[model samples]
Target chain A: MARTIIPFGPQHPVLPEPLHLKLVCEDEIVKEAIPALGYVHRGLEKLAEIRDFNQMIQVVERVCGICSMLHSQCYCQGIEEMMGVEIPERAKYLRTVWSELHRMHSHLLWLGLFADAFGFESLFMQFWRIRERIMDLNEATAGSRVIVSVNVVGGVRQDLTPEQCSWILTEVAQAGKEIKAIQSTMLSDYTVCKRTKGVAALTKEQAYELGAAGPTLRASGVAQDMRQLKYAAFDKIDFEPVVEYDGDCYARGVVRFREALQSIDIIRAAISGMPQGDISVPVKGNPEGEIITRVEQPRGECMYYMKGNGTKFLERVRIRTPTFANVPPLIAFMPGLELADVPVAVLSIDPCISCTER
Target chain B: MIENMKEITLDAVVGEASKMKSDGQRLVALSCTQLDADNFDIIYTFDKELVLTNFRVTVPKGSDCPSISGIYFAALLVENEIQDQFGIMFNGLVLDFGRTLYLDEEITTIPMCNNTKAMTVKK
Candidate 1:
């Protein structure tokens, strides 16, 4: 068997972001994969050192365009912990609404990209069409479609009125129904099943050992989610982490599809029980300690480690994104998979290279 | 929560990490913070049922820190990243990228370290 090496993207049609994998193959089967990052690295973590803690939220929000709100929320929570400020009840509920909305858009975006990877052009269009509702909702409420900078140190920057909340609930419910209809085809279709089922399967043990997180870990039956940590009104919300035991690409898809539905339910509940008061609390002084905060991003668990020195500028900000943790599992499962199945398996983890390289 | 952070020696990191792994603590993240001109703090965070436990180790610049990737394979990428950004050395990395994980070789100075001339200029 003659071995050949192929480079799979810093740019690829299937990958919406930049990630390079050097695949060594014997015939049609891949033997190994070496990943190269830094293609999209912008040194955001280093920038954190120069920016003031209050101003750094804006910088952190740009880490990943898909998970921007979650990043800012996580960083703000870390700073709040250091400052010891209690956020308003209304702010917590607002954060919940926007975060769940962020999750819905992110999962929908991923579903469309995943469909595109498998050459299902119509399915891709269907997913993106439904996702537009979320984008419109974001624009109407937060004043931006992509990087909704609604999070501040003590709370969120924006508030949603009762009418706006009701409108969002109606729109989300409509999108949920459509997603449910799409899930039947996305999960049970003959081509999707044949291409994904039993391909790039990771056992529960391997998933934990390789540090897989979020739906990637849940799909392997780990039952771990950062939302369970009860940050930002998650404690008051009623929801369960979606778990699938197959640990295959199909199971990963099923997990995200179900999670999108779960996000809708969570948003509905948060809105129904919306608290009253100000959306933000006044803050004073600089953060002067170190704290680690974790938030459940659409891809998985994103951890932020912030170290402050009693000054406006943070001494260090280390962002450990879900894709960084999930990349090893991608590399681990790449071998023993057919070259054609590589794209399907790679996209299953929902790789966000911008988040990874940040 | 601050009391939960346990400081360990560099030599004890591998053993302590393996013990935690065997006890079912998933490695949440590993972070390196520049402490001073020559000292760095390496923090390893683990989670069990959403409760976090942290282990900290402080090393001098250019010191050889043991790689916990042998026990927890997921540490490889973060370890390589620390090597590149902070210019620290790990003795037993599972997959050593040789300081090319996130930076090019042509860049001679570490970008994230506190003592880097670029960081000093920014300050």
Candidate 2:
């Protein structure tokens, strides 16, 4: 037998973002995968020197189109902690509503992409069909379908009116019902199960030590979620992480499918308990000192490390996106897999090259 | 300042990292901050049961920092990224990209380090 090297991507039809992996194979089985990034590296972290703490919120949001809101939320959370600004109750619940909506859309987008990876085009369209409703709610409330750009330093910039809140609840409930309708096809379809079950299986120990995050880690039964940190109105809402023991691609898909519905419930709870008042407060001074804030993104835990020097411009900002932490786990499980099955495994962790390269 | 942090020298990084790994703490992240032209501060963050423990090490710009990849395999990516950005060297990387992980070979400036006039290319 002879060994051959295959370049997986910097561009692949299945990949929504560019993540290049050099797959080394002996016959049909992959022996190793060497990953290469930097295709879309924008040096966003280095912009902290020029951009003021307030302006950097916009910069951080561009880290990933899908997980943009969570990125800014994490950034603002750290800035708030450093400045000792406690946001109002309404602001917290408002943040929670948008956050869960973002989470729902992000997971749905991944679900569609994951389905497409396995040649389930109909299933892919079905998931995306349910996802558009969530996007429409974003547009109606936050003025953007994708970026949203609603998080400010002290709190969120947008607030849902009573009518708008009721409408959003109706929309999410409808979307949840639609997603639930397809649960059997996405989960129990023989072809879907055949393509994913037991593929790229990472054990509980392997997932944690390799630094897997979010649904990827939870799918391995670790049950560690940044939402458990009680940021935003999560303190007021009830939540539990979705976990699956198999750690396979199928289990990962099931976790996201369930999480999208979970987001709907979280939104309902936040909106029902959402108090009236201001959505944002005025900031007086620049952030000084260091702080770390972690939030659960659709992909996983997104952590931002902020170092400020009593000036508007931050001294340093380090963003540890979920994809960056999950890459090693992707590599850890790549070996001993058939090269044909690479796409399903890669998409399982929901690789966000924009987040990773940022 | 990190809440659960202890200051350690560059030499003690590997030992401390081993203890974290033995204690079953996940490596949350390894962050590098440039204090000045001459010194860089590296913070290793580990998480267990939702709580974080951090180890801080301050090393000179030109020093060769030890790689903890042997103890915690996931540190390889973090160390490689630091090497490319700050022009620091990790002596024992499991997979050394040699400053080419995120940047092309032709791009010469260290993009993250403002104090450096040029990237120190070394083995």
Candidate 3:
């Protein structure tokens, strides 16, 4: 068995993010892996010191375009903690609605990419076409397709009008019905199951030991979702954290698909129950203290640490994204997997290198 | 319960730590900043539940804070990041701490520290 060293990315056909993994393969089986990060580090934490607290919201939103709303939400909560401000009821519901919408689109986009990676082109097209509804909702409400800077300290920047809310709910419900149909086909289809099930497997114990969070951890039978913390309006909504026990690519795919349904349910609840109140409150004084805020992004737990020295600019801002936590589990799962399955295996963790490196 | 969630500080956390391990609290993040020409502030976050306690310690010019890599493995890359961005060192990282971002062959000072000459390094 001659070992062949293959570089997976920094430029590869499958990855939508910049991550370099040196995969050592003995014939078709992976022997070992070494990951190289910092390729896309823009010194975001350093930049936060120079940017004012408000402007940094936009900066943090760019950490990863897919999870942009979550980043802004976490950042806003961190700043609010330091400043000791309470967001209005309406703002909380709006943030929850938008956050769930972002989750729906992100999971759909990943589903399409996963389908394309495994050469299921029709499924990929179907998911992305369905994703357009959520993207339109984002642009109409938040003013951007990718980096929706709706979150601000003490609340959100935009308010959802009644007409917009009604339209969004109708559109989202239709998208949800379509997603259920696609998911049923994906689950029952023999080719999709044969390609994914029992492949790139991580056992439940391994997942916990590696600190794998989000869907990867949930797929491995650990029902621990930071969403259980119920930040924003999740407590008021009816939803369950999707879980699967197999801990393979198929299980991960199932978890993500089911989670999208839960997101749809959350969006519907937020739309119907949204209260009328202020969207934002004026933040006063410098944040002289420290605050740690954690939110459940589309991928997993995204943590933020903020320290303010009573200044307009933050003294320091640190982000611990889900991709960072999931990388250890990814490295652990690489051994003994076939070379051809590497792309889907890596994608199974939903690597967002921008969020990881930032 | 609400008050317990608020007002998390060192004195309160130190009291809590006696019940936990010496470093039982999870290390959230480490940050280093240049206060003036030769002053530095290194802050570490220890969190349990929603409460976060911050430890801020200062070091003079050309000095570095003690590394907590022994306690938290994730601190390794963060130390490297702090070293690259602020020229601070964590004494026993046992890895290529700064090579991830800055690619200097043997330079010791942080590339982004105040009053430092620019290296062609991209951090």
**What CA root-mean-square deviation does each model show from the true structure?**
2.8, 1.1, 4.3
Residue pairs in clash, model 1: none
Best by DockQ: 2
lDDT of 1 by residue, A251-353 (tens): 9999999999999989988998888899899999999988899999999999999999899999999999999999999999999999999999899999999
Task: Encode model 2's per-residue lDDT on A88-139: one tens digit a residue.
Answer: 8998898889989999999999999999999999989998999999999999
Native contacts present in candidate 3, fraction: 0.07
Q: How many residue pairs clash per model?
A: 0, 0, 1
Clashes of 1: 0
Predicted complexes: DockQ each = 0.68, 0.82, 0.20
What TM value does chain B of candidate 2 have? 0.92
lDDT per model, in order?
0.91, 0.91, 0.78
Candidates' TM-scores?
Answer: 0.98, 0.99, 0.86
User: What is the Å distance of residue A136 in model 1 from its true position?
Assistant: 0.1
CA lDDT for candidate 3? 0.78
If both were scored by TM-score, which would come out higher, candidate 1 or candidate 3?
A: 1
lDDT by residue (tens digit), candidate 3, A91-118 = 9899999899999999999899999888
Cα lDDT, model 1, residue A201: 94
lDDT of 3 by residue, B8-113 (tens): 3333433443433354454545556677778776666555443556656667766645655544554566667776777655566644434445334455445456
